[model samples]
Target: MSLVSTLIIADDHPLFRSALRTVVAQLLPGVQIVEADSPDALNLAVQEHPRADLILLDLRMPGVQGFSALITLRGQYPAIPVVVVSAVEEPAVMRRALDFGACGFIPKSAGLDTIGEALRSVLEGGVWLPPGVTENAAAEEQEERELAQRISSLTPQQFRVLMMLADGRLNKQIGGDLNVSEATIKAHVTAILRKLGLYRRTQAAVLAQRLLRAESASLAELGSAAEGGAEEEAE
Candidate 1:
């Protein structure tokens, strides 16, 4: 609706990111484009560019667990809209992405014209879905939604700690990586466990793992390991 000025492209694949960037430039010439290749980088990009008009996100990016990153971004920055540009073209996945707060779902298989059309529509405050992917008004499971809400409540730093914990990082190591005292990381871990209604760090790790499994059965083969080695190592 407003003048499009800035957008964040959050995808791990450089070729796909370049394709999206080209389409975006054509759709809105002179628009500032910021690229983030991982979940942590996306978080930092959002922090650095809070007024971005939209975010183009890839669900399977390293350190991202299904819709966890989307949910967290929507929760933290409700004003900014996100569009899922992913290779996983399952209709169920597209619908679930919309249910989780993405304004649109554009399959990576889409032609450049279709991708531009989808981006244009969403940028103008419209919802977009690929052909044959109709919106399902059916609600998600109550338990799943509740968990999403809890995860969405996390502050960004807490989320980083949670993901690092999922990677089996200890408090001291997390502190060193985050550049703070071990006690601060311990506090963050405590806050994360309490907010997620868990009792221990392992539970938080398991919760992070569960978020990876949030997709439909068709995406069972897409494991966190697929993108893990490609990301900047926390170790």
Candidate 2:
């Protein structure tokens, strides 16, 4: 019998989710698969299946940006292994995912055989990356990693509040959305700022925005690098 009984799929694309489900079902027969299409659903799925064998995550999900979701999952469920299955197939992104605690990084463009190999490798307690990607490849900037660690220290509620703060929502507005008191929201904001080493809410917002922008910039940089490599290959 397979050791993995429960697996969670956290991607927004339904077709891709189905493809992953099929591959997993074939690889580990009888394994229970849970699908979460949004960040909230992913959180609830994790809360529900804390002992799940593995989680396949997409970086760009609704209500989460950059590595925030990965950080939260690692913070709250350290035992469960997470493998990022993202459309962004940059080596830098893969390394950043590993730095943020992913057990593996599988590009969405990978073939079924490659995906199966990655899954089997991770399931057997080994880390997996695309060919040519090193285990100790260059990671994200030190400051970004420090920010990620600080963000990881936040409780799930505090992280939600941080996201709302990034949207420039007032405390009262955030409280209304979260169904909490304004005072409670204020306390969360205070704690978030403290944990993040910031004095004002505006600073937290700017930092959060910076983290979100970093993903876009990273993708652009990856595109440029890939172009350069292609030109070199054609030379």
Candidate 3:
């Protein structure tokens, strides 16, 4: 008997999601597709379907800060392959996605045939990048890679605490948000700092800021593309 695959399509735009769904259905008949309009919804879908074979994620979806969602998913769901599908097609962005553990990077503008091929490659345990893109390890990229490794080591709870800290949330506020006590939040903070090899919480916040800033321009482009897509759908 043939195995059936489940793919999670996590993009904010309904038009794009439908288009991807159609492509997946046509390319991989009998595949199950779960659609998520936001990062939170993606998480819920993954939880509900833990055996999902792959996730196609959008970097700028609601509740995601740059590549944080990708990082979180990679850390939390290491068994499931994640292929980033985003409007940001810069080589640098693609490199970052691979460094953060994405099995493939498919630009939103890619042809359906290319998308299908990329998805198939990832499903076959191979990494896929756009043609002509070579992996280069510059000094800055090496630094980012080290940081990503450290971040990936965090437990899911610790990761959540660290993100809250990066957002400048007080320990009390974080505790309230997670429904835990301030003391527990403090311990999680200490653990986060230790894991990231940072002495101060401020350093963690700075690192998060740097990562988000690196993708800011691409995120702006993604927003514009989403808006344009919406307008085209309406016309």
Query: Clashes per prediction?
Result: 0, 0, 0
Task: Give the higher-lDDT candidate: 2 or 3.
Answer: 2
lDDT of 3 by residue, 188-231 (tens): 88777666666666666666665564364322121111112221
Across 1-235, the per-residue lDDT of candidate 1 in tens digits comes to 5599999999999999999999999988999999999988998999999999999999899877777788789878989999998888877677767766889999889999999889878988899998776766335444444555567778878887887786888889989999999888877877776666666566577667656654545322222232122212222
At residue 182, give the lDDT of candidate 2. Answer: 91
- lDDT, residue 138, candidate 1: 38
**Candidate 2 — worst ten consecutive residues by lDDT sum?**
226-235
lDDT of 3 at 213: 46
- Estimate the TM-score for candidate 1: 0.69
lDDT to native, each model: 0.78, 0.79, 0.77
When superposed on Cα atoms, how far off is each prediction in RMSD?
7.8, 10.3, 10.9
Ranking by lDDT: 2, 1, 3
Query: TM-score of each candidate?
Result: 0.69, 0.76, 0.84
Q: Per-residue CA lDDT of candidate 2, range 1-235, in tens?
A: 2399999999999999999999999999999999999999998999999999999999888776887788778878989999999888777678778877899999999999999999999999999999998866554455554555566678888887877777889988999999999988888877776666666566676666655642544321211121122212110
> Which model scores highest in lDDT?
2
> In model 1, which range of ten residues has the least summed lDDT?
226-235
Which portions of model 2 miss their true places by more than 4 Å? 40-44, 61-64, 137-140, 218-235
